[model samples]
Target: MAAPSSQIDQLADRIERLLVRYEELQRTNALLQQQVDSLTQERESLKSRLSAARARVDALLERLPTLKNAA
Candidate 1:
């Protein structure tokens, strides 16, 4: 049978490794959140610009005379 002290040492080593991996994952998660926020802001800005452009196009279309009116 293995000594109790050896088993305790093995468990401690595994715990340390798990902690390191947890920290790395936390950092990676933070980076991904930042990217998601940046993309969301960009998407909102593009949507606003598109809405403005569509409004201008609609206004211009209103000014054009229809074929029925031309006849």
Candidate 2:
């Protein structure tokens, strides 16, 4: 039979380990969430710039026909 004191100590150690793991996971989750938010903002900014660039390209394309007719 196992000693009662050793059994209690083992249980306590397991609980402590679980708590530590939980805290580590919590921290990792928070860091990942922050990174995700930052990436989302960057993606939105890039999309906006892309849209503006496309508009400029379209305007230039529209003028090409007029330029060719005059040549």
What is the C-alpha local distance difference test score of each model? 0.99, 0.97
Every model's TM-score: 0.91, 0.88
Worst 10 residues of 1 by lDDT: 1-10
Best candidate (score: TM-score): 1
Per-residue CA lDDT of model 1 for 1-71, tens digit only, reads: 88999999999999999999999999999999999999999999999999999999999999999999989
Instruction: Tell me the lDDT of model 2 at 57.
Output: 99
lDDT of 2 by residue, 1-71 (tens): 89999999999999999999999999999999999999999999999999999999999988776865888
* Error of model 1, residue 6, in angstroms: 1.2
What value of lDDT does candidate 2 attain over all alpha carbons? 0.97
- After superposition, the stretches of candidate 1 with alpha carbons farther than 4 Å from their true spots are none
The superposed Cα distance between candidate 2 and the true structure at residue 33, in angstroms, equals 0.4
**Model 2 RMSD vs true structure:** 1.9
